[model samples]
Target chain A: MKKIIKPFWSYDVEQTEDWLQEMAEQGYILKKLHRASRTFYFEQAAPQNLSYRISFDRNQGPVLASRFLENGWTIAAASGKWQILQNSKPANEIKAAPVRQGVITHNRNVSFVFFGLLFYLLGVLLANLSTLVSSWLQDGTVAVEPSPLWAITYLFLALTLGAIGLAIYSIVKIKKSNQAMLQKESGIAAAKWKSSQPTLEIPESSGRFVKKAKLGWMYAPDRLESWLEKMEQQGYQLHHVGTIGTVFYFVKGEPRRMSYHAEYMSTVESSYFSIYEDAGWLKIFESWSAMEKWVIWCREYKEGEEKPRIYSEGSSHLKRARRMAGLYTVLFLPLLFIYAVNANREFQEFINEGAALSLFGLLPAIAFVLFLSFIYRMWAYYIRLRKNYSVFHR
Target chain B: MNADKVMKKYIPMTETAFYILLSLTEPRHGYGIVKHVEEISGTRLHLGSGTVYGTLTKMQKDGVITVFADEERKTLYEMTDLGKQLILAEIGRLKELHRNAVKYEGDFL
Candidate 1:
C-alpha cells in the first residue's frame, strides 16, 4: 500500500530523520520525498525498527551513493539539501569505527544559507530605507505618516525580525547538535554502516507524469540530486525544469542509475553546455534566483561505466569555493555600509528630535543587529574555506 | 623537493591521506582503494566514497598520484615519484619516533 503525508516541512535534519524512522517503525517505509508539495510517500512494509541518518552535501553523486550501498546503508529518501539513509541495525553495531558525517557540522554550507537569508533581509532593509527617506523629505520632518507606507514598513520590520530569530535558532541548534555528535550522544551518534542487507522493495512504477512545485535554496545541490535520483528510481525522468526551479515536470521512464551535477554560474555560454555534452552530460535544468544561477547536468551510467566530474581537479574545487566566498563578500560589504550609515542617521535624528521610540525608531537597532550577525557568519565562512583550501593546497 | 622538505610538508598527513597514498602504491580504482585501506587497517579506518574521491582528486592535482587507467566508471590511480619520496620520508620519521618510544618504554610504567 502507498500512503502520502502532506504539508510536512522540516528545517531541522535530526527531526526529519526521526520522523521518517518513526514512520518506518510503523511499517511505512519512505519511498520518495516531494519538496514542492512538502509531502512524503511511503510504501507499506512489515514494521521494522530502523535508524535514519541525514547527511548534507553540495556535490554528491552516484559514487557517494555507491559507497553507502557498499557499506550496507540504503538510501531511503532525499529532500531539500539532505540525503536520508536507513540502517536496519544500530549505528555502532554496524561499523567498528565511527563515521563522522553530520548534517549540522557542515559549517560552510550552513553559513552559505545564512548569508543568502542575510542578503534578502538586506534588500528589504534597503527598500524600506528609500521609502523612509522620500517620506521624510516630503514631510520636512521624521514624523509618523498616515499612509500605506506604515503597513509596508511594519511588514518589512516583522520579516527582518523573523529572519534574525530563525538564523539565531538555526545556528544554536546546529552547534548543539555538532557537540552532541562529537560526544557520541545517544540522540546524535555519527552515522555508521553495518553488514550488507537487502533494502526494502519499492512499489513498481505507475507510468504517469507528475508536476511538482518547489523552491530550490542555495547550497542545496545534494538534496536536489537525491530527489531527482529517487524519482528516476521510481521510473520517472525529469522532463523539464521551470525557470526558477520552483516547478519540476517529470515524465514516466524506466528506473535507472543516474548522476547529477549542479554548478553555479552567473553567465551561461554555449561552449559550457557543449563541453559537458561532449563528456556525455545532458543539460537537465537551469535555475536563476536572486543573483545566483545554477545549471544542473545529468548523465545515466550503466553499472560499470566510469563516473565523470564537471570539476576534476582539486584547484578547480578550491577556486569555486573562493569565487562563492568572494561573491558573498562583494554582495555583503555594500549592504553593510548602507545599513550602517542609515542606522547612524536615524539614531542622530531620534536624539536631536527627541522622537519617541516606536517600531520605526527601533529599525536602526534591528539593522545593526543583523549587520553584526552577517559579519560573524561571513567571517566563519571565510575561515572555513581558508582551512579547506589549506588542506587541499598541501 | 628534497627528502627533508618533503618530510616537513607531509609528516603529519591525515590518516585518510596517509592510507590513500599508501594504497596508491599499486594501481587501484576509487572503490578498490577504499577496500584496500579497510583490509590493511583491519577495519579500523573506514573511508567514505566522497572522502576518497575528493582526496584522490586533490592528490592528483598535487602531483602525488596519477591516473593509470580509466575503465568505464572506475579510474585507476598509482603513486608518482614525488608521492613515493614523501611516503619514504614519512616512514623514516615513523621509525625514528618508534626508536624514541622504545628507549623510553619503561619510563611510563
Candidate 2:
C-alpha cells in the first residue's frame, strides 16, 4: 500500500528566500543537490516508517514536489523546461550531488509615501500632545493662564509635517532601490532564459575574480587570505599587493600599489564598509579604483553579470542603524519630554503664576511618537528577515 | 498586572524588549517593535534581534505579550495588562530619573 502525492499548489513565491525558509521550518532536510537540473532533493521520514522525496527548484522559488509510491524514487527526462518533473522515471538513472549543510536560514524592507503619511499623522499627535501638556503644566492658575495649547499643538503639527516629509523621501529612496534590484533580477532572468541553448556549457574558472581590475574591493583582509588559499588550490597564483590600512589587497600575481589615501568616501553609501573603514581607504589608480569598484569589477568579470552581492550590505547597515535609532528614541523621548517640560524655565514661569498641571503629561506624547516609528520599522525588518531566511533555507 | 513580579529580579532589560513592551500600547512584531522603539525615543535607543528576542522571551515568560494572533508566520504581539503596568512603572521610574537629571545636570535630552 504505497502512495505518491503530487503538489497541491504552485505559484511564484514573492520572495525565494521566504519560501525556502518555510520549507526548512517544516523539517525538510536537503538529501541531494541535483546541480545539473538546478534542483535539490529533501528527505523527511513520514509519520509511518517510510521516507518521502521533496524536490525544490532553485530558480523557481520554493517549489516542493513530494512522492512516496512504489518506485524507489521517481525521475523524468531532463527536459530543461524549469518545470518540476511529475511523471515517474527511474532514480538510479539520475545522478545527484552530495548534500552540504551551511545555510541556516533566519533572515528578515521599506516604503516612503505610505509610511510618511503614517509617521506624519503620528508626529502630529505627538507634537500636539507634547506642547499641550507642556503648556498646561506651565500655567498654575486655570482662569488667568494662557492655555498655550494651540501654540503647542501647532508646533507639534509642524514637527509631524517634517517627519512625514522625511518619511516620504525615505520611502521613495527604498522603493527606488527595490525597483533597481527587481529590474536587475528580471534582466538576469531574461538573459538566462535567452541563453537557454542546450549546446552551452558553463566554463570552469578556478579563480575567484576573473577580472584583474576589480580585485581591490574583493580583497577583504579577514576572509580573503583563506579564500585566496582556496583559489591557490584551484591553481590561481595568489599575490600580495601590499596593505591599504586594514584591508590587504590580493591579485592573481604581484600587483603593486603606488599610493593609498585614507579619506572619507562620501559616495560609498554603505555604512558596513564605512564602519569597516574609520575613513574610506582609496587605493591609487591603475588596478582597484575603490573597494566598491573592485567588487563591481569582480562580480562582473568573474561572477558574470550576476549583480554583486556586497552592494546591498551597505544599505542593510544603514537600515539597521536607522531602526536602532528609531527604537531608542521611542523608549527615551517621553523621558526626554518630561525632563524638558520640568526644566524649561519658560514653562515653570507659567506654573509659578498659577495654572493646572498634569504630572509629566508631556512624557507619553514623546513615547507615542517613538512608538509609532518603532511599529513602522519593525514591520519593515521582520518582513525582510523572514523572507531572507526562507530563501537561504530553500 | 503583576508589577512586583517583574521588579522582583534585576533583569538586564534588553534595549529591544524593554523597548518592544515599551512600544506596545499597540501590536507589533519583530520590525514593527524595533521601529516603534526608535520613533518614540527620538533616535535614542536602537534594539537588534538579540535584544528583541530576549525581551520577547522574558516578557512572554512574565506574561507581558500574551499571544495575540499570527500575521503570516510572524507572531503579532500585544501588551498584556501586566506588561502595560510594567511599562507604566518604567515610565514613572524614568520620569523620576528625568526629574533628578533636570535638577542636577541642568539639561536633559
Candidate 3:
C-alpha cells in the first residue's frame, strides 16, 4: 500500500536519514524521496531492519553509482544532489570512510547561494527603508490602508522574512553537516529500521500555482528540478515557470519519472534547445533573474538508457564552476559597495543625531555584519573551488 | 615530465593519493582500485567512491595517471612513468623517515 507523510523541511542530512529509517522500521520502506515538497512516499512492506545512509554529490554519475553498488549499498532514493543508500548491515559495521569532496562542495555551494539571497533581501529592505520611514512619519504606521503599495510592502515583508529564515536554516544545516563529516562520522549515521502501520494523507488532485523564491542562482537548478519532480508525482506537471521564478504554474498529469536538468546561461538562443532536443531532451522552463539565467529541461528516463549530462567533460565542469564564481563575485561586489555607502550614510546620520541609537540605526549595523559574514563565506567557497580545480588547469 | 619537478610537486602526498597511485601500478577501474586499496591497507583505509573518482579525475588531469581503457561504463586507469617515479621518490622519503625513527625506537621502550 502507498502512503503519504506530512511534508518536512530539513537541511540536516543525518536527521533526514534518521526520519526515513524510522519510517522504514515502522514498515514504510521509502519508495521515492521528494525533497522539493519535503515529502516522502513509502510502500508498505513486512517490517525489516534496514540501515540508511546519505551522501551529497552534485554529480551522481554512473561510475559513482556503480561503485556504491559494488560496495553493497543499494540506491534507495535520490533527490537532487542527495543520494540515500541502504544496506542490511549496521552502518558502523561498514568501514569508516573519509568525507567526500563533493559534500564540501555541496555545502559551499549552498552557503554561497544563501549569501546571495540574504544580500538581495537586505537590499530590498534598505531601498524601502526611507519610504517606510516617510510613510510612518506621515501616518503612524508603515502599511496604512488598502492600497497596492501597502499590499506590496506587506507581501515583500512576508517573502523576505521567509527567505531570510530559510537562508539561516540552510546555513546552519550546512555547517552542522560539515562538522559531522569532518569528524569522520561517515557523513551520516545508519538509521535503525523498524516496522509499523502506514499513515495516510489525501493527495492534492487539482493543479495549483505556488509562489516560491530560492536564493543563489547556481544552487536553484537542483532544487527546482526536485520540486518539479515532487509536484509531478502529486499529479501536477509544471506547465510554466514565472518570469522571476517566484511563481510556478502547474497542470494535472500522471506520475512519471521525469528527468530534469537546469543549465546556466546568461542568454538563451533557439540553438541551445535544439541541441538538447536532438539528444532527446525537451525544454520545459526558463527563468532569468538578475543573478542567474537558467533553462530547465526534462526528459523521460527510458529503460536501459544512459542518463544524460549537461557537462560531460571535467574541464567543462570546472569552467562552469569558474563562470559561476565570477558571476557571484560580480553580483556580490556591487551589493557590498551599496552596503558600504549605506553604512557610511547611516553612521553620519546617527552622528548628526548626537550619537543616539534607534532601532532604525541598529538595523543597518546588523545588516552590515551579516553582509560581511556572507562575503567571507563566498570568498572561502571561491578559494576552495580554485584550490580543488587548480590541478585541472595544469 | 621532469622527475625532480614531479617529485617536488607531489612529495607530501595524501594517504588517499599515495594508495591510489600505488593501486594504479596495475591497470584498474574505479571500483577495482578501491577494493585493491582496501585490501592493501588491511581495511584501515576505506576509500569511498567519491574519493576514488575525484582522485582519478585529478590524477588524470595532472598527467600522473592515464586512462588505459574504457570497459563499457567503467574507465580503467594506469599510472604514468612520472607517477611511478613520484611513488619511488615518496618511498625513498619514507625510508629515510623510517631510518630516523629507528634511532629513537629504544627511547620509547
Candidate 4:
C-alpha cells in the first residue's frame, strides 16, 4: 500500500491568514511559517488558487495562496514575485535584521594581538634567562659549563626575529585604520555628487532610437554580468555602464541606481521603494515606469582621468594587511617561547659579563613592537566597522 | 521498474500513485523514478525534478518506502509492504470518492 505523503504548500499571497484559517477549518495543519516574509509551509489536501491574509501567533502578517496538483503542491518560483508581494496590500514586509556575528570578529582581533604579545614577551624572557645563566656559569655557581657563546647568540637571533615580526604586524594595523577613513570620506563625496546630479539625457541618433536601460548598483562585477545576461535575454539592452566600489550605474534614456547585494536582493528592492517614497518620486500609473525611476543615487563614471578606483583598491589592501599581520603574529609566538626555554649556558656566562647588552636590548624592543602590533589590530577593526557604518548609514 | 510485481501489496492504486510506486519498485533513484513514471504515464504528470526527490524522501520515512542497495551514491528507494498497503487503501478511498462524484445531477461539472 503506497501511503500518500502529503505535500506542504508554500506561497506568497495577499490573504495568507484567511487561507490558513480556511485550511485549518478543512483539517489542514500549518507546518512552518517564516516570520519575516509571512511565507509558510502547510500540510493539507491543497486547495485551489485561494489567497488570504493571515496573522501568525506573534501577530505578524503574511499573505498566502495555495493550490494542489495530482503530484503534490510545492513551491514553483520565488523570484521578483516574492518581494513584489509586500508592495500590494498590507504595506511593508517586517523581519528583524540578523544579529551581526561580532564575537568571531572580536576573537580574530584578540588572537592576532595575543599571539604577537606572547612571542615578544617569551623572546625577551629567554634573553634575560640566558644572560642570568651566563652570569651564574661565570661565577661557577651552576655546576656544568655553559654551552658555546654561538648557541646563546642563536637564541638571541630567534628572539630578534620574533620582535621584528611583531613590529611589522603593528605597522600594518595602523595603515589599515588610515585607509578605512580615506575610503569612507571618498564614499561620502561620491554620494553627494551623485545626489546633486540630474538624470542622463539620451543622446540623439539619426539612425535609430534605442530605449533599453540597465539601472542598478553593481556590487560584484562577475555577478552583475550574469544579471545583465538574464536581462538581455529578457530584451533589455545596455548603453553605458560604470562601477564605483560596490555601487554600479547603468544608463539608457534615464539613469537609476539600486543596491547590489547578492543574498539581500529582496531587502534592497524594498529599501529602494522606501527611498523612492521618501523622495516623492513614485508615479503609480506608469507602465514600465518601475524601470525608469531612480530609487537611490550613487556616482559611477565609466572613464575619468583619475577615478576613485584607487580608494577601493586601497581598501582591499588594508583588509589583506590586517589578515597577514594577524597570521604572522600567531606564527612568531611559539618560536620565541622555544628560544627562551633552550638558551645556551655559555651564552648565559657571556651575558653575565654584560657583553651581550646589545642583544639583550634588541630582544625586549622586538617584544614591545609585537605588543604594539596587537593593540593596532583592535584599532584597525574599530576603524573598519565605523567606516562601513558611516558609508551605509549616512 | 515493475510495479505490478513489487507493489502487489498496495494493489488498488491511482494511475499516478501506481506509476510513482512502480517506478520506485526497483532501486530507481528520484530521477530514475521520474523518467519511468513519465514513460508509463504517457508524459502527463511530468513531475518536476525537485518534486520527485521531495516525494521519495517523504515516502521512505513513512515506511511505505525503503532504500535499495547500490554502489552509486544516488539514494534509490523502493515501496515497502506497509507502503503498498497504504497505497491500496488510498486507491480504494479514491474509487469511492469517484463513485460519489459521478452521482451529481447538477451542471457543476
Q: Model 3, B5-91: lDDT tens per residue? A: 667777898788889898877767565776788899997866643345556666765678765212121235777767888888898
Q: Write the per-residue lDDT of candidate 2 for residues A286-393, one digit (tens) a residue.
A: 122221222211111122332222212233333433444455446556766665555464456547865554546445445555555555554454455446655755
| TM-score of each candidate structure, all chains considered together | 0.37, 0.25, 0.41, 0.23
Flag regions of model 3 displaced more than 4 Å: A2-10, A62-67, A96-101, A134-149, A185-394, B1-20, B23-57, B60-109
Question: What is the clash count for each candidate, in the order shown?
Answer: 4, 45, 8, 27
Which candidate, 1 or 3, has the higher TM-score? 3
Across A208-307, the per-residue lDDT of candidate 4 in tens digits comes to 3343344322212224444644444444334333222222233333332322211111111221222222232221111111112222222233333322
- Going through the candidates in order, their DockQ values are 0.01, 0.01, 0.02, 0.01
For residues A315-340, write the lDDT of model 3, one tens digit per residue.
44455555665676676677777777
iRMS values for every prediction: 16.6, 15.8, 16.6, 24.8
Q: Give the range where candidate 4 chain B is weakest over 10 consecutive residues by summed lDDT.
A: B67-76
Displacement of the residue B54 alpha carbon in candidate 1, Å: 12
Q: Per DockQ, what order, best first?
A: 3, 1, 2, 4
What TM-score number comes out for model 2?
A: 0.25
For candidate 1, what is the recovered fraction of reference interface contacts? 0.00
- lDDT winner: 1
Give the Cα lDDT of each candidate: 0.62, 0.40, 0.61, 0.40
lDDT tens digits by residue: candidate 2, B3-101: 676765424343454667777876565557666777998967655433354445446656666542221212346676667767776778778879988
Query: Compared with the real two-chain complex, what DockQ does model 3 have?
Result: 0.02
